[model samples]
Target chain A: MTGAPMPRLPTGIAWLDRLTHGGIPARRLTVLLGQAGAGKTLLSCQIAAARARVEGAGTVFAALEEPPADIIRNAAGFTWDLAALAGEHFHPLDLRPDPDMVFAGDFDLRGMLATLSAKARQTGAGLVVLDGLDTVLGWLASPARRSAELARIGRWLEEEGLTAIVTAKAERHGGPADALGPLEFAVSLVVALERREESGGTLRALRITKSRGSAHSSSAHPLFFSHNGLEPLMWPGGDAPPASQERVGSGMARLDALLGGGYLRGSTALLSGPPGTGKSTLAALFAASICAGGGRAVHVAFDEGPEQSIRNMRSVGIDLAAHRASGALRLIGLQPGRDGPEQLLSEILAAVETQDATALVVDPVSSLMRGGVADLGQSAVRRLVEEARARGMTAVLTSLVEIGEDPASGTLSAVSTIADAWIALGYAERGGERNRTLSIVKARGSAHSNQTREFVMSSEGCTLADVYTAGGAVLLGTARMEREAEERRLETLAALDHQRRLRALEAQLTEAELRQRRSALESEAARAELALLEAAEAERRAAQAERQARTAASRSADTPAEEGASA
Target chain B: MSAAAVALFVAGGAPRSAAALRNLTAAIAATGRPEGTFRVEVIDVLREPGRALEAGLLATPSLALTAPHGRRRWFVGEFDQPELLAGWLGDVLDGEPP
Candidate 1:
């Protein structure tokens, strides 16, 4: 060991490289321990092929258990062309023991080492893979001998300045030589592959049990075997996509209004509801919205195939088929039972990459939980959302909640907790009909409506209408329609009654005006009559006074007239 | 006369290779085979590593025996037990010969 740090050789697998903190230490012995059929051989071959293909570094692959031809054939199944890399940059040595060969007294691995060294020299190999080392160790009768051989191999690898990968079978039930046996102490790095039978399917995980002089992830990472090769699924812990302030439409204007300007770009939105509650329809609408805006979108349908999803969405006026035909949308249908969460995520991510999608919709993401590994599914969904956000893609994920199950609880809540917006869809059963209802349970950093709108889907499109509340109960379906009609009727009757009362008040005012006019006229006539009577009386009095004055005294008449005038 | 070919693969003059070669010679002498009946070839893997790889040698001091009928048998390790080596050679040489 030197004071200088060991240089790293990347395995060409992104997540694996990240897990090992830059891949295995170069020119050091690394051991792979796994049970039978646990992909030890495949992984080692991939590492060798990657070294040859990526760095163009020469590599030697020693097949101790299988023939070189079989290794080559199996390598062809992957995307790498191992057969073409043979003889120049890549050298394969068949060291499988002959069945007829017998051990005489004592032997070492000198012949095998010599052959390897020769091949390494020929190709200038920088890496060597001793696949199925357990088979070679099995030939030895004693554990001490096996340990010695392993140490010898390790020293030889170090002296040759070659990175080496040795694979061995992991024993079960804590046997004396369980798995690593004495080889664990001989290598600088140890990677263990595991296969567990889950209710959904077989789950494969890779864990780095030991790494000397390097910081690495200690937890087991789910493995996905795609056409390319094995990939470790991990939530990237790198520079996250900057928080986007942009908002994108959810296709339905009213729904957008409820969400306070639609969904935030590069954010995750959870649409949770029971079956037939239009969760898929809403997700499709989101996808269609992105596509209609000339943005590429990916819709992963877990419950149905692409054609079925297209047809079903078409019935709800969410023309997904049109978007798909226009190359703006890609539909990926996955069966939960067929693959684990890792494979599903890989496929979905692959689709996103190929389509260069900016928006993604996973209909009923809760279906991933059916794999019987809740933790795995949850982590996978988290990774999916994180990856989507890292690319600044708006992700609309649908989760299926049991009919009476609370959307805020259960396994689906794990998804909702990470989502920026959570829209809970349910059935508001009233009047013998179950009407779909949607409520924005949460919309972070936005002023969203708290009302639960009645979600209606028709041949035209999906729409959100205000839910009618009568008394204390929320009305929906035909009950809401009937209530609206009754309110309209009551309004009309009230209007008519008001009009009648106004007309009667107007008549009363008119009559009162006419009566006041008649009274004034009568008063004026009475006054005039009184004045005429008075004048007549005055004339009569004047006549009588004149007769009396003519008889008594003209002077008294004059005085009376003067007194009257003074009064 | 039977023509049986035997090849010895060793890692150049190592102590194990010398012991294996000496034991093999003594074992053949004990088999009492005619001199022309066997053709022996000694290949030092350290000197000619390609020959060792071409022979699919997995250990030093390995003995590869081929009969006239092309039937082959391989033995690995130094033949420190001369009797065991002699018996194995006798079985191969006593087989159907050309």
Candidate 2:
């Protein structure tokens, strides 16, 4: 093999194909290893059916453990119509061993191999699935014989140029080496399916453990079983979706203003608070706003049913039921403890895709971590947020923080780190009442307010009120109202005091003016008295001169002398 | 038609197939049954692979016995122990009416 790339047969599953780089290597043997009920058989059948249906390639499906009828019946549960292609394009071989089979001497699988080769030639099958090889290997009586038979089968497959999938049970102890034996060394690729019980439900994961020529994803991808088939939840690999600059409303204008003009489109917002802090209410409002704008939204309620959520949101004036009725909003209710995080994430993503929604709300996302592994829950949430962002869908997740617990330190921390905006709702107890308070902890790519506003919910909807700070104490509820009233009263009294001081100053000015007028009148009287006295004195002097008329010559001489003295 | 039918499946001219055929003939002779009582047929799997598959043959050099009532018994391998093969054939033949 001169370093030529191996051709691939696409599995028709997007995520699985991506996981395998292109798909399982074509015309090569691929071994599927898993424990019982690990979905090995289903996966093998799916591949076979997909090859037949999608590529129109003939396929041979041989069931050694399960009867061919049972396999076909089980496959019918999915959307694949295997019955139509049963005879012409798809050949099912029943190779289940007889229960009473006796081995008298040495034997080999040559007969079965020859039969398979003949069948392949007849149907022109490019792919063959040997399900439950472990069951067949159990009959070989010795490990050496099993190995020989497996090697023979591998040779036969290669000689026939058939792309084969051989499924075997993984041993409980040791590793694939123990169960797979010689088959492990023969196949070009080995895919492992794992089913583990986490919390209350089972989680299925698929990993490509060995790929001889291809660069495949090493991480185990979560598997989801839907109506169509097994779908692997691809991790948000590669570069993140391009950041969006558009803004989306938070339904309430005040809250939007607090958030610096609502949330950024394609960004994730985490609403964390204790119980009854209106986290769900805020999430519902956000979803309702999206739907009200003629856009689709998916609200996944982990804590409550759809009806209960709708009924509860009604009290806050958010009519989610109407949006749901209008087909703009899809309300999905899931019990957190009933399923693992992967299942929840799958359902959420499915809903978003089916609804073509632009906004997603996982109300009380913290519930996912309650009874599950913390790391799995965190990854699931991260994947969900990343996927939503990749599709330019705004995601609003709510986390319930215990009262008095720091939201930044515990389970919410993981989610908060990924959230584009984090709104922490809290209770401020003052004046014998606990009032809801909401503060923006962080909002990336936008200028947000740092104030902790009082969050109020009424029949109208959710609103943010400016919190009052009096004497260095944050006042809320009746305390703020009382403080406001007291300040108004003080203002009124100060106004009256100013009026009184003005009147007193006016009185003082009038008194000063009256006193000046009195003084002027007194000066006028004094001047008049002086004039009268002078006139009287002149008249007396004249009279005396007249009396001295007899001495007129002397008066005339005195007057002539006074006149000469004046000159 | 014989009351009982026996088949010896073999891969063409393999030693095991020859030995199994020889052992089957000897076992039938040791049963002391009349010639017309049992019908023996030799099938080469290489020549007739479809018949081998129809017979549910996983290995070559196998023996199959069918009584008149449609009861069948399959024994695998080359039948190295002749006496054991004879005893098994005798028991199977005894189940049929003489």
Highest lDDT against the true fold, candidate: 1
Question: What is each predicted model's overall lDDT from 0 to 1?
Answer: 0.81, 0.80
Tens-place lDDT per residue, model 1, A1-567, is 646666777876666677777888787888888888788888877877777777777778899899989888887867678888888666888888888787987887878888888888878887888888777677676778888887888888778787888887888621113423565567788888888777665678888888777666667777767656786555434456677888899999998887778898899999988889999999998999999899999999886899999889889877888888999999988898677776787788778887999999988788765664777788778777787787889999988888767656877878888888999899887767889999999998789888788999999888988677879777888988888899999999999999999999999999999999999999999999999999999998888766655654745543445424433
In candidate 2 the C-alpha lDDT for residue A273 amounts to: 92
Q: How many backbone clashes does candidate 1 have?
A: 1
For residue A384, model 2's alpha carbon misses the true position, in angstroms, by: 3.3
Say which candidate scores most in TM-score: 1
TM-score of chain A of each: 0.74, 0.73
DockQ of 2: 0.28
Compute each candidate's TM-score over C-alphas: 0.77, 0.74
Worst 10 residues of 2 chain A by lDDT: A558-567
> Residue pairs in steric clash, candidate 1?
A171-A179
